[model samples]
Target: MFVIDVIPFARFAPAGALSYRFNEYVLPGTIVSVPLRKKTVPGIVVACTSVRDAKESIKTAPFVLRSGAVTTTGILPKSYRIALTKTATYHLLPMGVILREMIPEAFLTHGFPKKLFAGTGHSLSFCEKTYTLRIEEYKKIISCTKGTVLIVVPTAVEIDRFADTFPSAIVVTGALTQKKRLASLKKIKDADIIITTPKYSFIPIPHLAHIIIERESANSYLTVARSPIDTRIAINALAHERSMQTTIGDYPLRMEIRPKPGSALKSISASPIKIFDVRKKITQAPFKALPEQILSIIKSTHEQHGRSAIFAVRRGYASTVICRDCGTSVRTTDGRPLSLITVAGKRVFRSSNGDTVIDAKALCDKCGSWNLIPIGVGVERIAEAVRNNFPNAPLVLFDTNTIRTPRDARSASTKFDIPGTIIVGTEALIPWLNPSNPISLAVVASADSLLALPFWRTRERLARLAFSLTERAEKVAVVTRRPDDAIFTTLENRLDNAFFKEEDSMRKQLNYPPYGHIVTIRIESSITKIEKDTALVQSMLKPKTGIEIPDRYATQNKVVRTIVYKYIDIQKWSDEAQELSQKIYRLPPNITVRIDPESLW
Candidate 1:
């Protein structure tokens, strides 16, 4: 008999591997079916030792070892396994969790085809430009590369776009039907180029050599659902371990991924960015959501039979409702600001979480004041303004609220494609706009509102948004209350170098990203037990470097407390955090640790 150590693919599985008895010797990376508690679960075999060697250890064990059967005959690639281990360690998660997340459940439950290729070359390149220019470079590389080249994009729409460009390339996406996805997975070995979204980028392909990550700055790469895991980081780790050549292309690449000075590809020509001082507009028309200049531009575009786009940072009619009498803001039960949204033509206040809803006429919870006023413009407000100003214009609302599914996105894109149609939306609409068919005009309705977001990368995100707009429109107009803000100067001057230098300096001063790593530990418990739980985490961590303790707040009938740890060396800090995480995992309170979280909140 052989004693095999298995890491069960369960969310709440223990941190360490469990011992299982097997009749045959199983490879370390092979998938096996093991009895975990009352049910069978798929696990990865981490180690194997003969019964003769582990006889004494098994004899002194607390419980009998369960038998595990090999579910998949082929083992995972050694380099891939190492990459997974590094990912687990860096993210402070169990190997099982990493495995469960990285690989599709179908691949684990049912056997997947064995990998047929081993990457042999290592090179990393960065292109800080739009897809219009990047596509040519990608084509050249794809044509020159002998082995199968994997291109990863952020969305299904992008997959479709790339598939159209490379008609012979195999396309894999979650949008595909089960039968189609399975067929695509089976045919990956024969395809020379595979275009896929980040979700299925790990689909084992034969002769895979080059990895091209388009739109590397896309937020979709960093999943925020259950636990945050930056798939970009995981992909980079995998590439490094497998010695695969990597090319990451994005317009204004993320600060963390930006190439060292003078090494990145030259940026493409940008459209003229006109900044309108919204403060002056507000002084002239106190209630006007759309500035006069933007209205005139829309009129001109419509007259010329050209398409126009209006971008808003928020979705609802108003981003927040503030009580004038007591200076109190209307908020949800969880302390999130409430936005006024028009549902079925009736204005109602809804929380950002989209759960709590109240009539617009409702009094403030804290002040009980009827003197409440809506503050900050949103997409709905912008749409309403456009409708009033240009009553005869064809209008399309493009946002998460409107475009929930792929079908909806297609419909929105089709409507926006019509000449003279005005599409109003949030940042979500940027990716759908095609640069080849540039809009006659594009206006950022409220740049200040987007910049007001409390995040370190707000400026970077705004710059990216600006560039994306410039790429898709002939003329981009930004309406900002703070016209003197450095972001506007950067946009007007097209001085990305100056902007990046300033951004880097600020990040270094604040010890954000590139300069340092932050580990966010979120603890949730009853209002009564939250204080104790927070205290326990602080005491246990005892971080020597910078630490932040934000005030605990109530969310969904539970108190949520956040503890942030900032450190320089990832290798040293990750080890210490991993040990502490295991201890905290045993506690009663629900806790989640996120390393290098995309956002502090």
Candidate 2:
């Protein structure tokens, strides 16, 4: 019998590139008709090779033969293989698994949609900026070219603008209904240009000449929460396989960046930025009262002056409803701040016990208090405050959910026609404004919170957000408590760009992403002790396995324990890790090991 080589589809192991064989003539990159045990099934062909002579001599085959009937689909382009292999290795995934994401989802089922565009492209450029996109170059491409164009963006907001700019284009995302989705897919298959998110674009299309453009080169956040596959590598692979052209720009280079304390978004009529040190803004703000000053700013912007927006990063009335008496915060057993969940979002927590879902009304584990308050202010809460302060103000609010829709944001950039239209929001809330209206006034409250975190990407993220909003807004004011910290100074001056560069270098030196490879594994058990699990990991991964098992179980709580292993025998370790994970998974109904994590935080 001719042996078949089956390849798992992308969804089978998201963020993982390991291609598992079903033990059957799996054409390269094609779905195969095969048998699993006594049942007929489907599998993908990743690679074809003769059985090794050593193995052949040791074990006699059960009449498995190398026959000419098996077809060759040609080697998946060298660049395509490099991308798949690099993504698999660097992302700490199995080589065979990562290959899955490269294959379009449509090909895994029915025949290929070759009439439509498909394939990956080499990056022409990369931008870490928000809502990244090309400048004059993109306009040039569309004007001269006349083939089916597939342009992928991280958010629908970008797609909306693209649709408007190019009226003939069609947009597709998760928000579309089945009918709309099918229509959009059909449009993708038929139209000259298709603008869609990555997952939705995984149609059965083949032989595509795609132009891969990323305003923000796809990031980990690109993973659809349900499927959790990084579309960056996958889409790039497809683009390469089909000889598609690609252009990447995280954000515009000429865009504003708060490089210095004196610099900030100076209005479209002025410079890219007009930095306002909160220290001085604090002088403008009444020092005697905090919230009152905030309220007054709102009042002035609405009743006393022109339109402006206020941003509060934390959501809910208060982040923590604490006990003033005990001076203690209500917290989880692991010492995380307890939050007050909203009525709708709170009830939805019941759906996922796997991830910690705390109800806002749930009493504080410390000082049982309905006196609970929300610690951080979210976009919704900020919007509510603005609305309450200026009851008669004609304003439109935009958040992650609403900004996601291009139609809903049609008039988002228009100034308060009724005089005092104001928008209050979170970081994401501010970015939805019309790019042309680059002179809007805004206030960013609690922007300092993220600056204080120890995470490697914190500063870059903050800078990106600030840079994006400041460049778009006319006069932007950031009110932060840390007016003297490195982050503050970075925002206060352009010298901070150096810090970002240094940080980038540090990440490179440490072998962290864009520098090295990162794959994290998390194990959980309800009945097992943290110490015992750590001991087992130490014993199993013997010394000089060349794998770095960083100081056992970094953190542990009542529900779970975490251990991080950096740069080791990742492929073999993954297999062994699976066994250990299985062992803990079998502990009891309550114990579970969340395997092959795409994210650590």
Candidate 3:
């Protein structure tokens, strides 16, 4: 018999390793089925000791050890194990939790296959430019590579696009049926090139040589539902550990991952862009959804038999409702502004968080004023205005409300493909358009609203969004209230490198990403317990120089507090962070930690 230490993959598993007795000697990193309470769960064997060697410890054990059976005799590669450990430590999460997230549930429930390891070579490069150019580069790389290659995209839409481009490549996405997914797994072993989303990036492939990450700046790569884990970081760490060639490509690459010094690529777009100062027009007509210039361009595109698109920052009829008499803006219970949406031809108010819903006909809460006005622009309002002006033109509304499924997105894209058709939508519409065929005209109806978002990377995000639009359209118009903004000036003048320099300078001054690292810790509990929990966390932190603990705030139902840790030097802070992680792991389930959080809010 052997004494085995395993990391169990259970929803509520404990913080550290659990011990069990096994009949056969299970090697470290082997998958095994261990008895966890009344149910059996899959776990990874981390250590093994012979019964004779652990005799003294076993005799003085506090509890009897459960028996476990080996599910797969194959051991995980040393590089993979090291990568997993590093990821868990960096994210301040349990090894079991990180393992459960990385490996597919299907592979865990069933045993891992024997054919997993592959050859590798190490090289890292960046393709910071338009998606069209990125695609061309990818094709060249795929053609030259000798072994199996893996391309990981950020979304399912990209998976479909890549599959269309590479018909012979195997495709894996969460939308796949169980049987289809299983089939793809089997085909991956023989596939020379495989395209998939980040969820299945860990699936084993024979002779895997190169891993490519597309649209590396996308927010979808960071998950926030449980603990935040940046998939890009994990993938890069794994590639580095295994010494495999890796490439990360994005339009106007994010600051943290931008190429070093002189190797950085210029961020110029092929298409021309024009910026319109909309403040004068708004002052003339407060509710004008489209400027005269944009309207003229749309009409000219229709007359010339060309496609056009309008990008709105919001999704509803109005982003907020304000009382005209009292100057009060309607808000949700959590203090978030409410949007007015037209549902079933009835006006309704809803928060972006989806926590509060109310009828729009109600009087203002601050003052019993019945005179309320909708403020700000949204996709629905822009679509309505376009439809009213160009009733004969084929128009498609492409927001979250209209396109709920992949089928809907495909249908909308097909309709927009027709010449003389006008499509109006939010950011969701950007990925659907084919990059090869440039639209005749594209208009950003509300650029200022996007800049108003409460995130530190708003400027960077806006720049990426604008560049993406420019890449897909021959003539692009961005209407902004703040025409003098640095981003606008940079876009209008085609000064890509200048924008990068300015952004880099600002980030360095503020100690943001590429200069410093931030870790956010959140605690959620009842109002009564929140104060006590927050105080305990503060005590543990002990007035550190970089630690910031703000007052507790209320969400929809629970009280929440956040702690932030900012540090510039990894060597100086790593040991302290690791020690803090162990203490945090012992905390109650209500506390969660996020390393390099995407959004402060």
lDDT of each: 0.80, 0.50, 0.79
* Ten-residue stretch with the least lDDT total in model 3: 260-269
lDDT tens per residue, model 1, 427-530: 98888888777888989888888888877778878888987788789999999888777777778877545666777787778777787788787877888877
Over the stretch 270-381, how does candidate 3's per-residue lDDT look in tens digits? 7877998866632544467897878888899899999999998889898889998899898766666789998898879987776678898877877888788998899889
The clash number for model 3 is 0
Best by lDDT: 1
Query: What TM-score does each of the candidates earn?
Result: 0.90, 0.67, 0.88
lDDT agreement of model 2 with the native: 0.50
Clashing residue pairs, backbone N/CA/C < 3 A, model 1: none
Q: Is candidate 1 or candidate 2 better by TM-score?
A: 1
Candidate 2: worst 10 consecutive residues by lDDT? Answer: 254-263
Task: Give candidate 1's TM-score.
Answer: 0.90
Q: What's model 3's TM-score? A: 0.88
Ranking of all candidate structures by their lDDT, best first:
1, 3, 2
